[model samples]
Target: MLYLTIDETNTLIREARTDAFHLEVSDDHSAVADETEPMRRVLAGLPPFEAGAYPDSWREWDELVSELTNRGVTMRRVRVVSEPLTDYLRFLHGLTDRNARLGEDIRWLPRHLVDQADYTTDEWWLIDNAEVAFTIFGTDGDFVGAALTEDPTIVDRCVRVRDALWSKATPHAVYSPSGWSG
Candidate 1:
């Protein structure tokens, strides 16, 4: 169970050979402080800009995803969200189309559809089916560090869970976050 900094986790994702799968179960992740302005704009009913004109933060991620896609590394994410979307999730929803266009396969699963006890509460990244990096968050959902493991037991279990959730989630292109009243 080795601990990793955010940079280290990003490095792991960048180095993935075949696939990078992420599972996010939190409704609000305080780690995304950089997105505050963008989120505020979204919640305020502002329209998004052209992808080429997006903010630097978003462009940086787009570049990474494009690079990975060029390298033939498949990237996928499944977010388990509660209804009446939180501002954070709504922000993410606003950005999902761009993310999908950048080569990430993003999906959303409504919380009501799954048993809470069936999944791990932590967010995690499974790199190439070999390593599982579980994100540690503070009680307030602030970013802590990450626990990374290559232990087959942990990695295999995460793979199973990811697959199960992925199969059940709706693809981002078709899923509307209609629950967001704001």
Candidate 2:
């Protein structure tokens, strides 16, 4: 029942010992302004974001992922997106290569392929399989805060969901957004 600010969540992820799993169930996260500028540039027909480019927030994340990977910690993310893609998802798809290159194993899953009843609707991060941090978003799809718990029941469920979805999702390198429209 403990709540964490975004910075605290980032610290938790950075301190993960062996594994960190992120399950992104939403298609839009407009409140995360870190990528706002990059998204704007791309949407306006400009070049996509580069690793060290604008929005220092991304650079911070890139460094964290790189450091975690160097420490042999596995970081994985599964994004469950509905098609045709939302503009935000499309924006994310374009920027995923940087994440992959930085050592995160990112995957894309078509929402239709999943049985929603089996998973929590909220987005979450399973840190080293010992704790779960559920992301709380406002009605407008803006992230508000995170609820972190170490309860075995909830953590176990997240582990199961992560394993099941990871197996079915397509790796970022192989996924194609060709048929989808924003």
Candidate 3:
């Protein structure tokens, strides 16, 4: 089995979008940049993001925002913040006023942290597509990389960990109130 810390997950997510997609993110606030952010530094590419979620940030740039304009990407946001998610939702709406297309490509998945129990459609979907799985450490953790196989034993183990979080996770319905409040 291989493990991917936050950095690696960021890399893959940047690479995985071709059409509509799903992403199950953990409850960590360490912001990371995938290709979109770096690519944006030079030019505007890709239009419309698929489905995904993230906390709100006051930071100047957000990969989610950049990805939305990408017709190639369809973004769904689940802001795991300490404040009422409705507030974040409102903020997103505000952004739409400025850029109508902002609302066009992005959707707000039921905002919730990945649980340690059951898996969401998004989680299972992500795993199914993963020819390889990377275990991303949440805090002070390093990258552990392992290739996934169709083998029952390996797949079972991966399913166990993924399910653990998936079960305990709150659907984009619960608010954590710390990560994104801006």
TM-scores for every candidate against the unseen true structure:
0.87, 0.91, 0.33
lDDT of 3 by residue, 85-144 (tens): 343243333343333344323223334444435443323223343343434433433233
Per residue, candidate 1 scores C-alpha lDDT tens digits across 6-125 of 778778888999999999998987356566666777778886553455677566678889999889999999999998788789888887888888889999999888765457777899
Ranking by TM-score: 2, 1, 3
Candidate 2's displacement at residue 72, Å, is 0.5
Question: How do these models rank on lDDT, best leading?
Answer: 2, 1, 3
Tens-place lDDT digits, model 2, residues 1-182: 89998788889999999999999988888557566777777777677666556566666888999999999999999999888788788889888898999899999999889977556788999999999999976676566678999999999899999999999999999898657643
Tell me how far the alpha carbon of residue 63 in candidate 1 is from the true structure, in angstroms, after superposition: 1.7
Better of 1 and 3 by lDDT: 1
Candidate with maximal TM-score: 2
CA deviation > 4 Å runs, candidate 3: 20-71, 78-182
Runs off by more than 4 Å, candidate 1: 47-57, 115-118, 138-141
- Report backbone clashes per prediction: 0, 0, 45
The worst-scoring run of ten residues by lDDT in candidate 3 lies at 52-61
Once fitted onto the true fold, the runs of candidate 2 whose alpha carbons sit more than 4 angstroms away are 48-53, 138-141
Q: Candidate 2 — number of clashing residue pairs?
A: 0
Which candidate tops lDDT?
Answer: 2
